[model samples]
Target: MKEMQTFLKKYHEEMNWEISNESYEKTRASLLNNYMLLTTEVAEVAEELRKAFNFTHSHILNGMKDSEAFDLAKENAKEDLGKEFADCLAYMIKFANYFEIDLEESFYKKMDEVKNRKNRDVSLSRK
Candidate 1:
């Protein structure tokens, strides 16, 4: 993950896509714009899921088994889903790079914190 982040940092620099830090206003605008783009990519990920679900439903209606239809739909959507996820990751890495944040370290630290935290939701069980 760290290596990927480093690679993206250099890639973005080479592509001249890094967030601006020229002035406070410029930095603010750049951050907001990038955040919006990230959200758009996220929506594209959701769109891919919707497409897969619709495709699976169509196949099922045509008499295909549920699992087989879903599997085929999932496979068909995999490439576009991956591309959307990559787009999201690129924007996230860009923000992390701009802030000098070590995303790999932060991710592990956060996961550990969540792991150690007490669960809040109560389990429902039938007697």
Candidate 2:
């Protein structure tokens, strides 16, 4: 998707100062020992999802919900989750780029297959 590419371009430019091949390699060595593999991308996505969930539910960590803490959590969750989801998307886009995959076409194809499977299952069940 062009939108994904656009977002990725912006994100890459914004993060250029902080991200580099050496840093990536170090992270890869620590977490995966490989760069830009599907398994590594999946793991990064899962970690980002966990981070977003943690930020959204951080009020629970206080043992009891303080009104102030709950409000702060609510306020921060939106921004934090946005950042985390962006990170997830970045990894997915990177994975697609590394494999030279067209995500938009693949997405539609998979959706069509799923729809066909659902329709076939429903028709059979009515027999």
Candidate 3:
């Protein structure tokens, strides 16, 4: 996760240099814009989901008889899903960076909270 944070920070720096005269903190106000970008990215993910499920409208309307073709489609779908998910992650890192939040630390903290909740649930269930 640290590696991802470092990579995202470097990528954000490069983008800032290419695109803006303002500081990154100044960019925080533009988070609504980032949210819009994330929305579009999520749509792309939905498209990838269609591919992953091999459920295009044409595929649904016209039946498939070939298993080998579907195997290939599945592989391509997996690759597309990976790319879309990475795109989502990039934006999420940007969101975190905008607020100077440490995603790695926050992830661990949140997971610990989730784990404790699960443990509490288990204890209650046993009693």
Candidate 4:
């Protein structure tokens, strides 16, 4: 993963943006944009808060099979579970993108290929 300074330098070079002329309008616009970004991030955090421990919506959907809740919702059942996870995931993606983290590559290289391939199936283990 690239550090913030390195990523910003690369971004500036790629986009042809001059770091010298960061004027008031540019700063204001960036402030506004960052406010919007933070709002979205906070909403995602709230979603993570909702189904989290000490919350009402907990146990409404199993975390492992989250997509099934959407299927369940199609049959006149509704839970806000999907939105929560979606929002959290969206924020995570955008957070990585904002910092030019290349999270997909990082995940594959650092996590997805090692250490946790599978959880012990307790039911099968008993047999």
Q: Is candidate 3 or candidate 4 better by TM-score?
A: 3
Q: Model-by-model lDDT, in order? A: 0.95, 0.60, 0.72, 0.52
Ranking according to TM-score, highest score first: 1, 3, 2, 4
The parts of candidate 4 lying over 4 Å away from their true place are 1-79, 112-127
Q: Residue by residue across 1-127, what tens digits does model 1's lDDT show?
A: 8898899989988998889989999999999999999999999999999999999999999999999999999999999999999999999999998999999899999989977879845659877
Candidate 3 wrongly placed segments (more than 4 Å): 17-29, 55-73, 118-127
Who wins the TM-score comparison? 1
> What TM-score would each prediction reach against the true structure?
0.92, 0.44, 0.66, 0.33
Query: Which stretches in model 2 have alpha-carbon errors above 4 Å?
Result: 6-76, 118-127
* lDDT per residue as tens, model 4, 85-117: 554454455456545577757888877556555
**Would you list the clashing residue pairs of candidate 2?**
none
| Index of the highest-lDDT prediction | 1
- Tell me the tens digit of each residue's lDDT in model 3 across 3-61: 88778889888776222327766555477677788788899989977765555444544
For model 2, residues 1-127, the per-residue Cα lDDT tens digits are: 8678656657656865222346766645533432344455567656655664575466567564666665665565567556656655666666565456788888899989998884464444543
As a whole number from 0 to 100, the lDDT of residue 30 in candidate 4 is 56
Q: Candidate 2 at 104: error in angstroms?
A: 0.9
Ranking by lDDT: 1, 3, 2, 4
Clashes of each: 0, 0, 0, 0
